[model samples]
Target: MLKKTRVAVFVSGGGSNLEALLQSEVSGGMPFGEIALVVSNTQGAYALERANNHGVEGVCIPSRGNSGFEEELQALLMARHIDIIVLAGFLAILSADFVGKWPERIINIHPSLIPSFCGKGFYGLKVHEAALERGVTLTGATVHLVNEIPDGGRILLQKAVEIRPDDTAKTLQQRVMEQAEWVLLPQATAQLCQELSEKLSEGV
Candidate 1:
């Protein structure tokens, strides 16, 4: 049997990617051990409901714009002994101290390929809108390690989607999610877990 690695998924929105991850695990497509928890910074996030449907423990720890929020987050992570953190639509900017502790263990899915249509002020439909404005035929999603430098983390995987000539931002966003984000996030996560497993066996 493969040793289970506890995964904690963070989300701040609808959590389509989170749903993908959960479904992947349920269908035996995910190589990781299990999704131990789902944490959302927003109280009303639909992602929490999805977690409940799967019988996974979901918690909403609202960001209070104070040190208390960080303390609560750190406590939850430590308590669960989480092995990996998957940021599925999570928008909160983690503190430098938090990133320092987890390092490459945290991974995030970005709407657009990194180094383009990413970084500050580029999120949600804005990413797709920017791609269309630039007249780019190809735009996609990127899965990367999470660091303090916004989307500057090392890229793990990127999958491109073709942008239709008459596509609106919403339409393009859906295509990218269907073709890239949903497919690549789980794959990258499985690969990361496999690498971690090998490292463990090698005593790294």
Candidate 2:
């Protein structure tokens, strides 16, 4: 029997992506694991509300005056016994120290194809807006390993959609979000879980 590893989702927004993941898990289409927790940096992140709605253990630790929040964040994650960390709309750049501890165990989803409209000041609709300004004929989402520099992770999977001449940022973003459901999150998480299970069997 394949063991189901536990996953912890980190989010900083509405958590629509997280919802997709939860639905995927519920559908039993994934090859491995299920969400064990939903951790958020925002106390009131709607993501947290979604977590509650799904009965997922929700841990909210906003930066909230704590200058050493990164260390606290790391400690919290460790205590949760998280096997994998999924950055679902998690905006804050985790400290390099924390990232080093997790290594490829961390993953994130970006709105635009990386190595393009990604970097400081690029996120959410800002990325979609840039794609519109550049008149990109094709646009999509990328799922990748998390790194120190935002959006610099090695690409695990990416899916592109042709942008119509009339495509606005909102329309393009809606399209990308739809693709995000079909392309990035579900398949990647299943692959990650399978890989983790294989490594365990190999005693790596």
* Number of the top-ranking candidate, with lDDT as the measure: 1
Report the alpha-carbon TM-score of model 2 versus the true structure: 0.93
Per residue, candidate 2 scores C-alpha lDDT tens digits across 36-57 of: 8898888788988898888999
On TM-score, the candidate that comes out on top is 1
lDDT of each: 0.89, 0.83
Clashing pairs in 1: none
Give per-model TM-scores.
Answer: 0.95, 0.93
- Span of ten consecutive residues with least summed lDDT in model 1: 194-203
Candidate 1 Cα RMSD (Å): 1.3
The CA lDDT at 16 in model 2 is: 88
Report RMSD (Å) for each prediction in the order shown. 1.3, 1.5
